[model samples]
Target: MSTKLHSAVEVGHLRKVRRLLTADGANLVNAGDGLAEETPLHLAARLGKADIAEILLDSGADPQLRCRCPFVNKFDMNNGRGDALHIAAAFGHASVIEVLLAACEPQAPDADGYFRLLDLTAMYGHVEALNLLLERCPMDVSVRSQALCFALEHAQIECARALISSGVDVTTPRRLYRPDGKGIRPLQFALSPYSDPCDDHILKTEEEALELVKLLVEAGADVNANATIAHRFGRYDGCDEVSILSCAAHYKLLKAANFLLASGADLNAKDEKGWTALHVAVASGNPENVRLFLDAGASHQVTWNICTVLDNDNYKFTKKWTALDVIGMCDTRILDLRVSLDWKKYTLIGDYTEVIELLVEDGADIEAKHETRYVGNTLLHSACSIANLSAPAGFKRSEFENGIICMNTTIQRLLPTVAAFVKAGANPNCLNRFHETPLHVLLSGVMNAIETVSGSYKYHHAYNWVEEEEKPSIQLLFQCICRTVRVLASAGADLN
Candidate 1:
């Protein structure tokens, strides 16, 4: 073969190459002029030319010559050693594979001490060629097989099964495990989490993935066993100790959860969140799992809020009970009590007329304080904040001072609850334990509004009210000063 014939043979132009070879009287063994150092047979095999490869092999071409191209790039055009069998296996040509395997160096190990043919077949997911190599080839199966590279990575189940049944030990001491505190096995690799963030191949859905888990479990694999390979792969970098039961629960595998649980997995055992499996069930919103936890004798604790209150409440109280009853009469939630003192605070803030009517219908405490600190402000305190606290002009006062505090006023026309608070005997003057009066709060509100208007502070620009023309409704500071003087005169507030 001439130097140019190498390119012709590589492209499977056997007829043209033969004519040139015959014309030049050059033998098939001649090397290419290029740095390939490849024979006509090497070129044919590299291009996967089976017929041309046979002709070159018969024409006294040496099959043992390794091509200049790497093993991964080589193709089999003719039956040749090193190169020919690898190409046949790469393309999954079983007949060509058999011919090359018969002629090639079966015992020869590549640079990796693994046969290139087995690796090629495994990469292609070729079950037949993989089985033939594992069962019959003189090549060492103990040496890592190429089947594992793709078999473990892509999860070629059929090829893996064939390799396993052909007596390739599923727990073989291959390159799968690392030297950790304890020896990890190949079985663990099948169950381990993916190392790559982009690799979703660990298991796509709960079902397809669980089948592998179940198979390994059936093969007497440890369900709760923590393999050392996790440490080797850096998978558990930030993870605490996680076992099979924990993994199953984390994966939300109910069947796996049931298996792990039934096998005496800790149903109440907490993960990093201190959350039990019951919490997981509830978070998943799976009612069936909720029933499972309940059946497992899990107790449902009553949350503080009524919105999230479970039917599992041990104290059979009505939903319409008071805040005092909910907190077991403890005075700790006094701020919550203040916020919930009236219907306005607890209920949605809306139209004063409707809110007042609704609270009146609910039989809310008209003059009751939520706690000792919240004295004098009933739901009326909250209603007054919205300009809704109303009372008859002749109504007497036992909750605060004498009949000087009039509840009914056309103040409802002034922005609902804030005006209502003043009308309802909520002394904008009532000092908390901190001695901060409501005027202090109102003053802060005024300053915040000014800052917001001037853009000196960031404000929620969504609902900004730019003054088209400053309306003279008694200035806020003057009104507050006047209200303070009137409150001191009426109720004798200690301004000093």
Candidate 2:
């Protein structure tokens, strides 16, 4: 065919294309076997020329011809890739896709080949084209599930719904990824704060997120199914087995959390840490979420795992913390719950005064202190051991200054937290096995507490080796530590 014939198709000159096809006849229309050789019909399909594509197909342009394009990954790479179907689906030309489907001689290729074509349409989020493919090329459950995975991997929600409606079982214990990659299951993904790296489309509204969660549950998805976490963080950090309700709480997906609760989800389910949804919600520090779980019958009596970061970085003491202790030990907005690893919450500290007050008012044990089952040390004595802080903050034992944080950065919230604990009637004079009072822990963290303690202890929390003259930050840390000491004294912290 002449350039004018191709040009007419390019500019959508339908009549001119008709005259050219008959004028030149079928011999020149295809011109070659593979469109990689630039067959006229393939170009028309690729350009979304639906009318022209029909004309070519009618004029004996081979729809079944394989595209010999060197970009095999685009069209020919898959097992049973269709030439024109692949091109038209990629550009999302539903009309053209329909035309080619009807013209397909041996019918659409087997499931595997069709799925490769689906990848193009699904990734581009072409819903209509996807529906057309599904109808023309029926897939078995395995293929349908693979197609659903493709849709979700791209956040193609509309396509995913279509696949689910087409019977892609959501209950098969699906896991998306692991430590080596971004991983989570279907229901967990919908309720998670983390988005898959490949997702271009994501859940938009609270209603949408909640709806998907509900949809998955209705489709035989088990809320209590235990999926190995893709990558551990948040409430499920150290736990490999967990419930969907706990996941909702961890991400603060309040709508989903409420929906799950209404749908018979186990509200107070405990995993390896003896943590319930209430504990996850508390650790998340969203008071509204905390209240939600609490109102829904989640327990305040549950013990949650918490790390008390001391001035030292070596002695990481994991203790059974009540919701109240979580307020003291970490931030409300949990950015990283590397609890299984560093447990560094790496957060911008916020005032927990109101929330702590709320928890205490709600009967959260303000005095829910205890020695670690193994360590047998109270929060203070366990906190200030020189052996634990001896390292150069390698274990991040003290989250207060994990290289990303500095001592002065947390001073404002620090004072309020101490006041909240003291006001809640938590005993500062309570002794750990070491027989030291909480005042000793405070003095041990900062060498001196506001210069008000009857006398200074021999040991100090601040690094004395770093010269205050060389760095202004070191001097600022000293000032903050002194202020922290003052707050403890004003709050009536007792020396043992």
Top candidate, metric TM-score: 2
Off by over 4 Å in 1: 1-48, 60-84, 107-109, 112-116, 138-150, 172-184, 192-208, 218-220, 230-496
Return the TM-score for candidate 1, rounded to 2 decimals.
0.42
lDDT of each: 0.43, 0.58
Clashes of each: 23, 4
* Per-residue accuracy of model 2 over 264-369 as CA lDDT, tens digit each: 8887777654666776666555677787877777666666675656554567877666655555542322223322212233232455556666777777765544
Span of 10 residues, lowest total lDDT, candidate 1:
337-346
User: TM per model?
Assistant: 0.42, 0.62
Could you report the Cα RMSD, in angstroms, for every candidate shown? 20.6, 9.9
List where candidate 2 sits over 4 angstroms from the true fold: 1-47, 52-91, 99-125, 149-158, 175-184, 197-202, 232-239, 304-319, 330-349, 373-496
Predicted structure 1: lDDT: 0.43
For model 1, what is the error of residue 7's alpha carbon versus the real structure, in angstroms, after optimal superposition? Answer: 5.2
